[model samples]
Target chain A: QQQVKQSPQSLIVQKGGISIINCAYENTAFDYFPWYQQFPGKGPALLIAIRPDVSEKKEGRFTISFNKSAKQFSLHIMDSQPGDSATYFCAASMSAGHNFNKFYFGSGTKLNVKP
Target chain B: DAGVTQSPTHLIKTRGQQVTLRCSPKSGHDTVSWYQQALGQGPQFIFQYYEEEERQRGNFPDRFSGHQFPNYSSELNVNALLLGDSALYLCASTPDEGFGGYTFGSGTRLTVV
Candidate 1:
């Protein structure tokens, strides 16, 4: 089964604090994992992504840590800001056959960063 | 480059009705994927279109169908809508696997009465 599970259905943090969301998957065929940010009245956008070959990746304030053995990964926001308050989703895919087509997504976690 | 675009930001329909939602992919993108996000839940994959063909599909029933045009634009048609079908529909576009992460459209919010 293609399934991605995310934790911390909701998160609240103070500005400058670290905000983290975790996800686990059952399918080992998945090679690409991406994190998306979504605000109200908008669609989710790709914030950052990671491949299984790497242990971690960082882009500006966003980072993704991956564990190939455990089939687990997570997103970390350094120095969280109020503007970061939104819903985040973790998704995985078997990029090989898809031409990167078929992808699976996690339920999502709503983050509320306070000033 | 212009990002993916969708139509009819919001719509309302009653049970047994049919609805159509449209999407235009980002500039230079050739593939489009559709997703359904219910309240407080993650977006579920409905289907994906590439090269003007239905390349893949999710677990959704046949009532949930779609079409893709040569221009890389796409449409999602839901026949005999039900209350459970009410959700935010999103469209995503990408060039190929090498291009990576998708660019998603703002989405069409549908409510069923």
Candidate 2:
């Protein structure tokens, strides 16, 4: 089962536009949600993460909006730039015992920003 | 300090052969996990090691196995390799304490012919 599901397999946006990717999870036990950005030939790098306790967390141009009641979350990039073009993955994890460290990742979204 | 380190960035092997991939966790980290990523697909967990023991595993078959040493470095051994086994193998590390995400290595690309 795909515990985490992401939408918009690929996206193209004009420079300075807002890029949005959405994801949802089925497991209510998930308490930690994180987004990762990956460039070609490299490992996925953590972008921003939010816990169920908060509705939104932002850092620089990247923001993660989470809804625990809905088991949904999204990553919004404001003023998108060419440098932001890359594959984005959304992941969910549980912090309890036994499975405290494993992450369930979504398929991924390939974003391309045109200047 | 060095991040997670993986050896032999790339490898090629024949079907039915056995291959071993290695990983060294980030300095001071005691837990290591392996993931497999196929082309155009997200990573799939293989297994995790802690305290020189296999603590958790994914849905992979028995042909996929691993071991962890006292130093926390780990090795993934795949026996009877198949063409479907070709993928990028990634190793991630995290400290046992605190609630933080894992740090991943560049990964070892394995091609099975």
Query: In each prediction, how many residue pairs overlap at the backbone (N, C-alpha, C within less than 3 A)?
Result: 1, 0
Q: Which stretches of candidate 1 lie over 4 Å from their true place?
A: B97-99
Superposing all C-alpha atoms, what RMSD in Å does each candidate have to the true structure? Answer: 1.3, 0.9
All candidates: TM-score of chain A: 0.95, 0.98
Angstrom error at residue B33, model 1: 0.4
Off by over 4 Å in 2: none
Cα-based lDDT at residue B86, candidate 2 = 97
Model 2, B1-113: lDDT tens digits are: 99999987999999999999999999999999999999888888998998999998889999999999999999999999999999999999999888778898989999999
Please report how far candidate 1 places residue B77 from its true position, in Å.
0.5
Candidate 1 interface RMSD value: 1.8
The model with the greatest TM-score is: 2
TM-score of 2: 0.98
lDDT of 2 by residue, A1-115 (tens): 9999998899999999999999999999899888989898888888988999999999999999988888899999999999999999999888886777888889999999999
CAPRI band for model 1: medium
